[model samples]
Target: MTSVGIDFGTTNSVVAHFAAGSPAVLSSDEPPADWAGLGFDRVLPTVFGRGLDDRPIFGWQAKQRPGSLAAVKRLLRAEERAEVDGIEYSVEEIATLIFGHLKRSGAAQGVGFDQAVVTIPANSRGIARYRTKLAAGMAGVQVQALINEPTAAAMSYSMRSATEETLMVVDWGGGTLDVTILRNVEGVFMEQASKGIQKLGGLDFDSALARLVLDTVSDSDRWTQDERTGFRLDVERAKIQLSELEEVSVPLPGGQYRRITRPMYEQVIQSQVHRVREPIEQCLKDLGGSASDIDALVLVGGTCKTPLIRRFVADAVGLSPAPGIDPMTAVAEGAAVASAILGGDLDDRDFFVSTEHALGTKVLNPNVGLVFSELIPRNHKLPARATETFTPVRDFQDQLQVEVVEGDPEKPLDDDDNVVLKEWTITLPEPRAFGEISIDLTYSYDVDGILHVHGEDSLGNVVLDEAVSYGASVDKRELTRIAQRVSRTLDEDRIAGPPGPSASSLSAADRQLVNDVQAKILPFIDDAEATQLRSAVTRLEGGDASAAAELQAATRQYSYLL
Candidate 1:
């Protein structure tokens, strides 16, 4: 019955629990002796590495180690496994390792680790969120729910404040930058808008500083992998030092030292820092509010420790970050608060989340080919439902293919800015003229941020209705296997030649005969029978003189279905 809050961050992760009526961060039971000295007892570096025996290592022990991966959270959307020293470990596996460690650490603190609420970036896509849940499941920890990082921070912040005020959160972590605007209405926090910039965070700052050091090196390209890693570690240290001191000397791979001034460090990261303004501005615009409307500014993530970042955010919002909210532990603490609320420990507060992207389907337009028909617009509050009516684009089109997509409402269906989440084919009762069959597509988005689609035709016949979280029900590895199986099936088909005669290879008379029978029986036949009939037509068209009898046999068999 002890549910905790876990912030699975990009640069670092933290576990917290609600004990004695307040959220408290948990320190590792077996933490490094100097972890507290380094301000890391409550923070676990999001690093994964391999030990001498090729076993896995995580957290503090894995930092800068051989075959170690830092900022692995950024790669969750791009890849599933990472090859470390000849071993391929899946992203979920790495997350499981991290979660398992956190769970044990909580257990050591006399806290139950069986169920917990986890946090993710506000703009994390469906795949990443799904994988996070999967990882927690693999770790034997049931994820009570997934909360957005900024929303959690707001929750944590709200617990300390008794006044009703609008809050803006700027979360710049190691992987992305998220800006959220929310309001405190009668003690309930409701997110009004959120914006995110991918690949903009603390790690990018490190990379920018590393590039500056590389420019000073004589033969930077020739540095071995080990040298490069060491240099990166040194650069990150120098960057941290530069935040506190006016200047610091970064040790190079060859024992050379490069002095970096805070001014110079800020200049090197100016581009990345400046990009933060866009999300902030957009979030304000999305919520129809400006700097004066925000009563408090909340900052989350270690990256906010940079003085320049703090200054930039303050100047952009015309408000300083609220006092007493620790950037390092706010998210975890907020998650813990969420846990307490869900556990019924707190009865005075609640929160509502908003959708990050527009949800809709693709419709064919005579003028534009295919256009996005938005059902639920972006920034819509969760637990929402929207229905849109569509029809067939072509006469005699017996099946309607509805493609569920999420993205900018203004973007084209095929644009890279939009993603096709799912595709469904609704078999109609019969062929009809263009625009004759009324098909209703309803998209219901639940509070968990999962999407369910309901589709039906004019006759009240249900076509398709299912919960779709980017196919989270199917494991990614299983999806890969299924894809590979399909590919092999296609390859085998190609190698075996046409299952049916190429319409091009058929004589005019044979082509007409095959097409006539196929059109007549395809509507009544099942998929397997339809495929067989097509193959028979192909044989006839392929100049198989013997194929005429086979085609005729299929025609008679299919005729019974009609």
Candidate 2:
């Protein structure tokens, strides 16, 4: 049986299989052409609906229904429950709906696999990843491993190259932007450091452009509710056009309009770009290296296809970006390659997989409410094990709680933030003094990075035994039924489709701002080649303003245009 690799993205998802001789992206029941033009053979919309019959409908079909939620990924971490037509769902339930669709699609393809690997964001913690696995399980797929997105991309790159070199993988996906530095030493690609920002990605750029449009055209008194909504939609379209063309004109109400220039788009999204760069810089600094040290800068993810993103990455890494590879497909392709390797079909000589961080628990003081001992340190190799001892807070205390946490303590709530008291169990023991040690907390991370917490008191008594669970869980069958029913009802109430190209999508004022940006950036785009223009557009449309500013600064190589 072939092992499957799945990239469950926020905006889209794809499944690939390694069979026969090489990896192939699978085709869905949906036509291949219907898939997102950015390239995957099976690009399914990450949207699912609850129909009146309570059966979940997924992909483009689900989106066709009225009020069907398109961006469920945004609600994954939301404390508030998501509801459509009186049916409520948690993130895990939403994931189950999507996974259920994938399962059906795989069955239709007649490819059965026992083990599968799923890709996740670099910054996701053990609990979030575990929840993903659970969701997959509910869909009837057994997850064999959880791989980081950038690592998967690197694996794919290594499969294509024979020479060993250090490379930086900049993955600008729809909902997240991740940067990873890895060294391919003698064919083994080892990650030195990885970092990312949660809020930066393509969607932000769309919103930014929309806001710019609204600001330009609508007056506080004249703007109707419908117009405001329409402008937002138009702004998204304009952003798409700006990615492909030099300038895009959006029509507005009141006989007024605005033209969004490529340069102006870049200015509009400069802050977003800069946000993406901060992590890259931090990764480099952590690795004790500089941009010049990298042999190549690899860009991956749908958002990276934008010209601006490519240019920003190339300029940041001090080298021209690689050609011929589709950034969006790279991660899935790499994941497929890794699946092949794990199945023992591909030569292991080309690449090696190792855990880049250690998993551990901290010993906390009940009385002081402070962490006193460190059990695990970052960057420890995988399949790792570590243990620590803790003393009782009071004399003759009968019970103790073993709190398992993640990440480094020194940084304090950083991107690498640690999860405190994730899982704990009460232990009963004989009376002991405050200074007398009572329990030993041993934290172990399996090959797949799932954390298992084991505790034993001074008497060698096992206290808490279950593996730590993260995130909420829902009844799959019930959720699917509710989603289906809600979806059907929503379709009945639909009078018109989602907001179209109107002043609501982008206002006249926003168009003027885009024009202003064009006046500043058009000369640069005009002088730059097609490749340069594409990179600039990617950076601009990817919606990281800070990254855009960096691209502007780094592209000073074309300073003559300025």
**Candidate with best TM-score:** 1
lDDT of 1 by residue, 1-562 (tens): 5658999989889898988888999875344553334346678888888888766677767775767887877776657578766678666667766777777677667885667899989887655676677566545566778888999999889878958999999988888889999898886889999988766888889989988877878888888888877787778777766767899888877678999899999998987899989889888898786789999999988888899999999999999889988888999998988888898997787888988888877877888788888888888888889988877879978887667877887866677658777677778876778877788878887676767777888878877665664442344334333323333422311111112333335677666667666655565445765787677766666666667656654553222111
Error of 1 at 105 (Å): 2.4
Put down candidate 2 lDDT per residue, 62-110, tens digits, no spaces: 6545545666665553333567545776666677557666766776788
RMSD of each: 14.6, 21.0
Model 2 TM-score is 0.75
lDDT for every model? Answer: 0.76, 0.64
Error of 1 at 299 (Å): 1.0
